[model samples]
Target: LPDVRSQDGFRASLDAIIIMRSNLYTVGRLIEAVMNDNEEEAMDCVKQGADCNQVNKHGAGAIHYVFTDLYLHPPLDLLSKMVANGADVNLRDYEGDTALNLAIKKTSLRPDNTMYKVVDQLMQWGADPTQKDLDGNDALALAENRKYLDIVKLLKKQKTSLIVPPPHETPVPSPRYQKSTTPYESRSPITHSPSPVHPDWGTPVLPAIRSSDPLIAPDREESITSAIEDDNTDELDALLNDPHANLNVPNSMGLFPLHVAILRNNPVSRNDMVQQLLNKGADINVKAIPNEDHDEGGNTPLHMSAARDQLDTVRILLTYDPAISPTNNEGLTPYNYAEQNGNSEMMRLLKEEQRNAERSNKSSTCVIL
Candidate 1:
């Protein structure tokens, strides 16, 4: 080691290690590296002083991006590296899901050790399975439901569980949390099912809606529509496990569960409810067919949310990639709804998302070509 080095020389050497970029601390690169599953690049970023726990706008870090559905296994090798470098195992994302919750949700009974291994490794790394998701489902329930017996046994071994935080502690996902579902389809939803009971429209969910029941805790026997409108996240969460629960099925008044949920207004439960509905395959862009209530008819969930000036709800919906310009039967788009309410923020948000959608399309087109 050379002695008597100049202060300026020592400072320059430190800057060189970080690649002296315009942003200086380009931690965003670390997020990108993990998102693409590039272990080599991820390590390089860490070596150059990237914060392994650096979160995106959604409060999700490298660990949060490592999960996929049953068809793909989480990149545990990369996850291990991030955790070793001080990444948080329990950081909640926009969906209020910790890494453990995502792992269980994403895993299935594959031929061999393709997926279950991720769950084991996460548990070993101090992932607390007791941490409940937005809808109050924990890792144990998720694994048990899927019949991943190995994972269930592993969770059962841990005798301790966490008490869910109060509503004040519930994490709210910012607008940047990615919702990536394909926009509205022109086809109708799955209707005419008799086994699942329809909601009671007479018990209005919205303040100005047609029902009389006060928003309360979800009941053991609540219909999907009533559960949604009442912001009964617990009931809605339990119902999602039922293979027969169909959110797309419209009620007698032509209102789908998603339509009711947008107006539910229970801030604590509303976002989680919307997320649950979407995750269980609710159609993001389905329109309400014209009915006796023509004003309620011809509006998409987006239109309803906009008309109600529900900014947080709109942000959550926008993440799922709703069609910004889809016209209702009355030929009004979501933008028109925002405009009529004079919600300048919603209008601005809609415009920005429109630009983002256009850019995303171009990127997809480029990749396809």
Candidate 2:
């Protein structure tokens, strides 16, 4: 150690340890380090007095930019470092959003993103879920609003301790918390299928199919359609598992069970049912031929989701078939349907998906070349 710490000696020592720049200690370098997943350099900057909670021009910090799903590696590793370095988990951005809020918003683009892991870590580190953004939406509200049920479920488990202070007003209960009053039959275990029986469709209708095969019960077709429309996954599962169940059989209007599932508003269960049908070999790009009721043909499940402004379902379908761009009888692709319905969100998502598909094709072509 120096014998006497004169002002000049102190200045020299400070300059050696810290890079005094125009922004004092540029937080942009910290963000760039995170973006590149350079943990060692990020820690070095933090050790030399880089603001872990520093906000950029967009009022976002290193934490806000760490939720992406585009990287080859999980961003959680870098995120863990940020939190470990004493980054404020609950530090609000200019929009009053914490790191968790940004994670919830980005889930729309990549529903299969690592948001679940990111959110869990945030909560475990005492990120306050009750903190509202400028739009007066908390992490729970953002999750519910965006129809990210998985996040909602995760947040609900931590609700008891998430509140920093007693909330000024009681929050509205999300639909997931509501109990269903409709009676449901217990499903058989996954290994076996239940005997085919007419399911309760609330109203009796003439049998839609007449087949000698025991699996294709006359009334079962109508019942299965009803089950899909009503978001009854248990019955839907039973019908789907049966080897003879016509997964692609369209109804009187030429709409398949998958189409009906996409149109329904129940996201969590509807998504599950869609996945079940897909797993059981439902066509990913099946279209609804025009009928008197719905004169629009060439409308696949993707189109239905876009028309209904079901972004969650849209994302799910897009992940499976990003190249889908079939036009309906009216010569409208799913993007057109979104535009026709004035759903800007759906329009943006569909266009972005199309762009992604185009980029992927170009990449494939380049590899072949």
lDDT (C-alpha, whole model) for all candidates: 0.67, 0.67
TM-score, per-candidate, Cα-based: 0.39, 0.40
Per-residue lDDT for 257 in model 2? 77
Off by over 4 Å in 1: 1-222, 363-369
After TM-score superposition, what is the CA distance of residue 98 in candidate 2 from its true location, in Å?
42
For candidate 1, the 10 contiguous residues with the lowest summed lDDT are 184-193
* Candidate 2: count of backbone clashes, pairs at least 3 residues apart or interchain: 0
Estimate the overall C-alpha local distance difference test score of candidate 1: 0.67
Q: In terms of TM-score, which candidate is strongest?
A: 2
